[model samples]
Target: MRGFSLLDSSGLPVAKTCFDPANIPEALHLDVWRQASRCGAQVDSLQRDWRFRGRTSNWYTDGVVFSHTLCDATHYQRTPRHIRRGDSDCLVLKLQLAGHQQGIFGDFDHFSSPPGTLVLQDWAIPYNITTTPYEVMAVSIPRYLLRGSHLMYRRNPVITWQPDSPQARLLVPILTQTLKSLATASAGEADAYAAGITGLLDGLLLGDRELLQSKYRERDRLEDMRQYLSRHLSDPDLGADHLCRQFHCSRATVYRLFQREGGIATFILRQRLQRCMQEISRMGVVQKGFLEALAHTWGFSSRANLARHFKAYYGITPQQAVEAARSHQNEGQREMNAPYWRDAYRVSRWLESIAPGASPTEPAGAHGGARQGPRELAGH
Candidate 1:
């Protein structure tokens, strides 16, 4: 279509760190948050230029992250850092459009992901990514939505390639075409179309297994990797090599899976940090010795590394995260959290509900207790 445009207008753009770059490296900090209020979710994004790696990344920050990417010939890897620390159990689904993609989420691996590959991967921990030619479509949906949202395991990648399947071939292309058309429709129609694509993908991943099992091998492998990550967190050599061995895949294969995601070592450290974060949230901020030992026991080697990684992952140090947790419990961080979690529509509903006339108590002369015995109740 001519002059296709699909930019969200509720917020501004920013070139900021991915997490809190003061705590991370400059390269990894290549991110900026932009306000977006298009979808029903409290939407926003943190985008970055990936020319060095020859790529572009637009990480949606709110409801399922919807990313549209483009690039020339380039080597790209996106190892996302957690903007909020702690144990977050969510699923992510990546739909490819133009180029090939490869990813290693946990123990599962995708060597060459071509168009129509719906990669249902886990985001509870860290993973490495590589995208080629460089255009890809991705949407990150929370696992809770898939318990029944649309049948497409919103929490997993339903990547498939079955040459014999006509239905999958026909519909996947239609969905992609519709999404592209969304770019050219009336702004309102575009938004609706975008919304519809999200619905279609959600269903595909969570439902329609008759057409989803072509890549069942990858799905089973993913389950294995998730098990390995949690079960072997204590093993110091539990990263790339170990993962490669467990998957019975080559080292080169492993590297491609992780790409530049700080390599396998970084993934291991991040997972350990994530566990500590969960403990911090559950057991409170008091430095329990076992918890401190737990850090070293998991390969942190020292508390400093533990603290540093924690801050980088969550944008706040352990202590700060704990404090933020407490404050969040008290509805204090709503000042920041509300802006990120509640989309325009939800916020509007909130504003309308609590706007000047909002009240919890009943109105005067309402049905609930209208003078329990008004003159009509004289018989009482």
Candidate 2:
């Protein structure tokens, strides 16, 4: 919606950069930079969608942020020199949408960067290049975000990720397609576009980390609340309906999200008895008083009810469960005694949020079906 001005390739928009190519001039117009200079003498004229280019002769670092764009069937050359020092310690993370590029990072090595190829090389460093007629897109990003790429990779560059990695394939498309549709800003719009560039860069390096972070946060929040409930199950008010009221969610929504294994009441009862067994076993001796006390505390009205459910869930009577727990040092049988039965509820709730009423082609994994609790839990 907002326009951000960025310099782009003169002819068909090809080349290199650190700034926003999306905010540059339209590929057909070519007004971002008035002229192309091989080393300030303007050796190579901006070929009208054809010819070759070079690296930057004199690179400025600390003060100015450097960036450029190159399009298909074009090349801009710069004079080569041994890069000594400058504020720009970063390298170019170039994406090859079409054609093959030959880059000389330190020694001459042919870099066949093909379409969807992502390569990294230093700018404040030094390099030379001989080109063929092909379309290429690149960005001169800040060095800090590239991990060890700043100091370790100038002379000997490496392919951190292949086009085949799930992350690379997912992100490269977004970058290349947007650059190919480059456009200049409407004046005074640079600030907005700069912000967008930050977002785009984050998407590239982070690989949906931000998105996954939120999902973990959601799981943590729910886990914190669930753990707290283990202590107060005896309070009949511990069911999902009550939790919904406390958490300010509707009854149906709470049931759908938090009780997939069984309804809220069932999960609460199970966790309560399991906790009771744990407390009973910790005394190091199986006793009826200890068992009954914990069972009632967790809201089991009578010892009989607790024993019935405990036996059904864990295949053990209260007396036997306590003995087993004590032997394990108060550790309850989590494999079958915990609230696992409730997971289907949470997963179903997760799916509903992303694609309500739609059948998921991919089911959750062995634990709960999805790798992360629920499929929709990704963007949490």
Candidate 3:
């Protein structure tokens, strides 16, 4: 409790050390890769001030207390490959001890926090954060701990509440003490403690039944907005006013929900661009018709307007994206055919070994003698 120490999942104590980038060895990249892998994301250090100190008190629960000065870095959660490989569905609660950070989640709303702010992040969605040099006490809560929270439906993945509030004022100290005391708790004991911990969190988050109901309503409205946008991506008339009329919500309420993603218009434009990119990547621009017509279908005024916004958003023109998609598809095809090509070569070698006169390119029924060659090769 006096100095930085770590307890493994098995309750073994570990010494702590500082990882300073200035003095890092060549293997530092691999170490960073492994750390990111364990944290269930891909990490890129954008700033040179990379200094991290961490201690995993419970590996079984992925609980840790870490402090770092990892400036200008982003962690990606829902990339296709990352999802295919699978991710540990967990929630991270970060108690900022010093400095501040900004996080983007839930349809691109950006939230910023200073010291004494508790931030919640879900591991299943795509979000990014840029932090100033800061110290934080981070606790990892297993997905099961967040059961009944209906986290998936909650559009605001990064929720920040300041510890200065009366409830947080009492809850923060209790949580800190509980975590420190349970640092050595056994696996079974940890599970028991986690229930109590989750109870505290439920109290902190819900506060009262009315507040819980409000959150549910907000979540439903967010989902409704997303659904409406998807269904009417081609409707140029769709905008903040249309959303307010459709959902029967006030303009203010709609704006607040989408503030992090710019405004309602920006959100719609972003979605349209995203949809266009997906279609272009799959069918290519050729199948999607003229860029101007494609733009009209997705609500853009003209091809030039679409091209201007698309380049601004993605840093590339629609034509470039099509080329990239083609390249990616080609690479995928090559990978898929590599094994088949190797097997064919092996089969040809076997046929030649069995019957010298046999042609590798010939079909199995090309010759009576060659037909027997496969049987002889199978025997060998």
The local distance difference test score of each candidate is: 0.41, 0.40, 0.51
Best by lDDT: 3
Encode model 2's per-residue lDDT on 1-380: one tens digit a residue.
22233333122221112213343223311222212221211111112322223221111111112233343222222223312212233345566655555433332222446566776554443443323334455444434333333223432343434699765675466545444333442212323333344355544544434322445555454555565666566685667656676678677766665553356665566566445533543455654577667667778778788888866654457676444334333222233221221222222232222211111111111112111112222221
Give the number of the best model, judged by TM-score. 3
**Lowest summed lDDT over 10 consecutive residues: which window, candidate 2?**
355-364
TM-scores for all predictions: 0.38, 0.33, 0.51
| lDDT by residue (tens digit), candidate 3, 17-89 | 2334444333243234234343354343323333343321222222322222233222222344443333444
Query: Which residue ranges in model 1 land beyond 4 Å of their true spot?
Result: 1-151, 154-214, 244-249, 256-262, 285-291, 329-380
Instruction: Give candidates' CA RMSD values in order.
Output: 15.5, 28.0, 17.3
Q: What lDDT does model 2 reach?
A: 0.40
lDDT of 1 by residue, 256-300 (tens): 545534566665665676566545544534554654575677767
